[model samples]
Target: MVKQFVRQKARNITPTQFIVFTYLTAVMVAALLLLLPASVKEGKSISFLDALFTATSAVSVTGLTVVNTSETFSGFGALMIMGMIQFGGIGIMALGTFLWLIFGQNISLSYRRLIMVDQNRSSLSGLVYLIRSLLLLALLFEGVGAVLIGSYLLAAGYYDSVPMAFYHGLFHAISSYTNAGFDLFGDSLQSFSNDYVLQGLTMVLLVLGAIGFPVLIELREKLVKKTPNFKFSLFTKVTVTTFVTLIILGTVGIWIVESSVYYREMPWHQQLAYSLFNSISTRSGGLATMDVSEFTSPTQFMLSVLMFIGASPSSVGGGIRTTTFAVIVLTLVNYALGRSEVRVFRRTLKQEDITKSFVVFSAAVMIVILSIMLLDALERQHFSLIKIVFEVCSAFGTSGLSTGITSELSAPGKVLIILLMFMGRVGILTLLFMFRSKVTKDRYHYPKEELIIG
Candidate 1:
């Protein structure tokens, strides 16, 4: 009877609720797996809470760790974390759907709805095709990335043995492509600071991972299949434009603030490299060429802002997302120019899209501010406010970049960060919708009123 009730309830749950539960289940299972003795190093032990936190971080693709990943996790544990990163990067729903297809099981409407919500799709058309392409592309990119980086490491004598070199390469490749900031390298990409070739490859993979899948699909269509007269959607245009614009602004912004301070005596080339790589990573890459704690407070705040904006929608990373940020900016521009509606790329934006954008932005601001306040209250005595703020934004954005204070936080602080990471991964909109009723609507409308404009 109990089993029947659960089966019945599962069938009737809303897509949003189902998504939450699915991700939650994944986190719990991963946490339990991490708690096993085989998953830890010979002398290291892990508490359930720390395991949960690490699991959440891994499944969210957020790299914030309560323990040193390299020192704590055994080889099996590291491999498990990599698997979780891949699973989280592609999504649990995508993986389940892929398995179903493999077994030649039919994908029903219910399955499609889950996929739509998981991938943040607006429509239900061609979902099966999308999953197939996603899996295929993931393989192609990861395979090529591992070979290039691993082979380079071996040839460059970074690793004496072939297996170890390729294993490390494969791990880093998955992490980079998934925007999963977890690293086997103790200092992230810091040891490779002067290795332009590795840095360049990693950045390319990061961008590809965070840039929305829709844009990638369309690009693949045009570039690979040579689709004739292919036109880009408004979403792709806005997303790409905002994404590129932010990278430029972030790079320039970092350079500007650092020029008179940290980079005062540094050469121009090194300065550019640091500025550019940090800018890109700030937007969800999480990998770093240098210690971010060395930067001025202003620069750290700047990095926080980019993390809050985050990667493009339908991608691995999180925040309010690039489109949401773009919509808010465009709306302000339209109003300032005496226009009524947001317009871009020769197309007018829908009213619903604009409203939803504001909703996301407002909710994100509220959540982020509250989390920062709460963390400040808890840990301000031990850490700087700027560091706390950066950490909070990092959790919410799922960027995983930290100021070396992650492991030192109080128990409550770590829990708060874990919740923030979960929220960041599943999204603010999802959380909001989880409480909304699916069966109820107002039968009659009240008279509308307008307040004085700001």
Candidate 2:
């Protein structure tokens, strides 16, 4: 009777719900781990709420923190945080499958479905193989990043010892590759502002982490496998085109906006570097080479807009996703030209994808706006609207850029941010799927009617 009851309860849980619950459970467990006596500093203690927020941020790879990670946590706690970042940055199921493969365990259909839901993939076929390939690639990239970063730190006199330098190198390497953005230096990449080597490497890692994995996979196949007549998927094409375009626009927009402010006296190279870094970071990296608050009001808001768009689908970063933005943009352009169908790259997009893109975009905007309004209503007496707006967008994007207001948010505000981070990481579509009503056929349909025209 107990077994039957448990089975029935299990049957009631949808894949999306299970994925959501799994992330929540992981966050809670990580929070608990951070609270361990071994994890905390010798003289420090962290509150439950802060620990949870930090865990959620790390797990979501958003990098927003209410407390300073460097000063508050011991090596043990840092390790726990890094573990969360790795698993969270890599979809939980992908890492799960990796461990399973290492153990020589058989993959099951049920597990594949979970992977599909987790990675936001539609195909069950090749999902496991994709997982195996991505996991290896991630490791390879991180290892190289760690070695280069650590060696630079040692040679450039950032650290006194090899072990300590490599330790930081390893942490930053993982954080950058995962787009986790956590820093041990206590000020993010701000200290390395003049160090273009670190900045370049970090940017490369961030891009690798945030660009869609399928794009990376295809590029790898073209390069390594020497595949003949290999073609980039439409998803890849749209994603890369949109990503590059956004970064270019963001870099120029930022440089122009802050021309009379942050860049007024800066060298051209520094101007270009700072603008490009902020643009990329705002998209998903969250590790800033400049203080976000130091920027002009227009630049800050521009970054908020960038954060709203966030990263590509199936990447470490989160948002409505680059492809969604691309589809929506294409649809709007096609509509403006009186074209009925949306076509790009010599191929017509599926009507289903176009519709889903709008759904995701509309839902994301609604979530961001409502969250901002609610948060302002909650904390307006203390914080200004723009700060709240930036925080809200940052949380929802899981981008982690902030104007130094994160720690000051009230408990409810923190909880709201937590919810946004989880939603962003878990995904808008996945959340929609989780609460959707079961599919059913209607016996009859009401007459179609149009009430208004835009």
Candidate 3:
């Protein structure tokens, strides 16, 4: 009966609106669950604001938290948080479709439309297969990650018992793979900063989660099926190239900026590991082995830029998206060279795509700047401008890493962060579209006129 009511109501709304409503509903449900006495460590009730904030963070897969994960939340609460991470990471529509399949319900056209919007797909075709593949791939990756990390945690004596080790391992696996940034360890893997096995496994999961699901599907087709002369789509090529390039640039930038500063006394291997881990983490993983505050100003600024870039489109992570960045850069380069058209990988870019990319990028910049200004005004006496900017970027990108001011944020500051997280997850354009009036054909054209150039 409830499902029927929800479906009926959802049918009345646009897909973008439906997606926003779904996440809001999830946040409310998770908040209520976390409010239960059994969810807390000492059976003490948590404030409604805190519960809502944490729920929003989890459902948004943003890791900014007011309370410590290990000390405040009991096993049940942690599991609830983990479940929200998976829901947010994979998307509510995918999970709904998976359950519908299990219950032998027919997927309607409306359902497919919702999935298309949720996954950022251009077409409704093969959505069911896509959902199935996504669930299976997620389970396989998280399962293998759990086993590897769990066994290693047990061997390393991180936990007193196998069950505890497995629980933490599973939590970390889900969190890292989803790029949710939640951690069972109090310091967020800091104790194992030099643990190459753990960091390496985590980095792999992070990349897989943030690289976009379509890319993974394409990779499977090419690598597993051994498709003859399989070629990646333009989307795949752009996303992958931009993703790898950002990682390399971030790694080198951090190493150069921090080598003579923070990592001066550390061994070369440890320095390399820290640089690589931080570079990846800043891009949306959120797990930190060292305090971000320890880094120099230049490194922190670079991280803010990386966090702003975040991850790829149609993936767990957030930001303006890699393709948008790529398109904007290409457009600028082409314009500077006086090229007739923007081109990439031997293919001419669509003007519509280029325009949309700039729109998205411009809106993102505006939002981040406005958010930083608001945060600075609210918490100027408590924190520096850079810290406020970092926090704002982290919230907007859903990257979750902080210079330790999350807990100190005032009520208004927290609320602002919550809005930013929601906007980041739902996307700037989607949220803007919700308020935009419907469009109709103009059926007429205006005379062309020259305008002043820059």
Candidate 4:
């Protein structure tokens, strides 16, 4: 009877659900392990809530923290956090498949499809081979970043010894590249805002991570081995164009808004560096050198816009994605130009993608609105509606930027943020798929009627 019951429970779970459940469970278990006496400083243990919160933040690749990361976690704990960042930054499935590749085991068709779909790979054929290449690319970029940043840190005397400097370099490099935004720096890079080397390396890491894996694969195939007639996928083109556009706009917006106010005393070079870093990081990488809360109201509003857009699809970062944002912009542009089709680069986008963009936009907005309502109720008179909305959007988009409201949130508000993070990471569509209703085709069609004119 027990065996039968267990079998039934297993039967009820789908592959997709299993993927999400496995990741969540693994993150929770790792968090718990990190909270163990051996993993923390002074042999201090973490409360259940604190452990769960930190674990969620790390696993979601969201940088929100309820406790001080540098103080609360020991060397062992830091390593665990680093592992979480690596796993969370790279989809768990990719890691699983990579491990399988190392063992010379063949991945099943179902698993390959999952990777292909989740990573938005160009093709499902030879997925195992692709996995190996993807893993190599990830390691290569991350390693180079670590070395570059470590060399700089060593020169700057950021740490006491070579080992410590190397470790920190590896940690931040992986974190930044994966868009995990986890920082070993006690103050989260606030002291390095004007440091040219640090800013340049971080920007490099962020761009590499935010550019989808498919782009990297294509670039590798074309540039490295001299593939014939290499063509960049539409996804790649859109992702890069959208990403660059947003960054340029966001940087300019920050520079203009904060120039005379928050950055008044800083040199122009430092101001531009800080502005661009914050602008890119706001999209997905959560590391902040400047005090985000110190931004003027207009700059804060601009950041909220960037964070809402988030990172590109299937990339380490999260958001509605650059492609989705591009679709929305294209749609608006087409409407303004009195054109029915949203054409770009000599090609017309499919109606399905346009519809998907609207759905994602709507879902994200609804979640943010609902979170704001809940936070408003819980915090009473403590925070403004705009502040609450910004915080909630940051959590939901997994952007992790805040207006000094994260640590001050009540229990209920924190829980709301947690839900938002989970929803943002897994996506609203995936959540809906879990509860999707069965559908049947209908032969009959209702008469068309116009309901409204705007």
Candidate with more favorable, higher TM-score: 1 or 4: 1
Give each model's whole-structure lDDT: 0.92, 0.92, 0.90, 0.81
Off by over 4 Å in 2: 440-444
Model 1: lDDT of residue 454: 68
- Give TM-scores for every candidate, taking all chains together and pairing residue i with residue i: 0.98, 0.98, 0.96, 0.94
Candidate order by decreasing TM-score: 2, 1, 3, 4
RMSD of each: 1.2, 1.1, 2.4, 2.1
Provide the lowest-lDDT 10-residue window in model 3.
Answer: 429-438
**Pairs clashing within candidate 1:** none
> What tens-digit string does per-residue lDDT give for candidate 2 at 282-366?
9978898878888877788888888989999988989888899899899999999999899999999999899899999999999
Query: Given candidate 2, what's the lDDT at residue 395?
Result: 90
lDDT of 4: 0.81
lDDT of residue 271 for candidate 4 = 87
Q: In every candidate, how many clashes are there?
A: 0, 0, 0, 0
- Model 4 Cα lDDT, one tens digit per residue, 42-78: 9466777677777877888888887778888989999
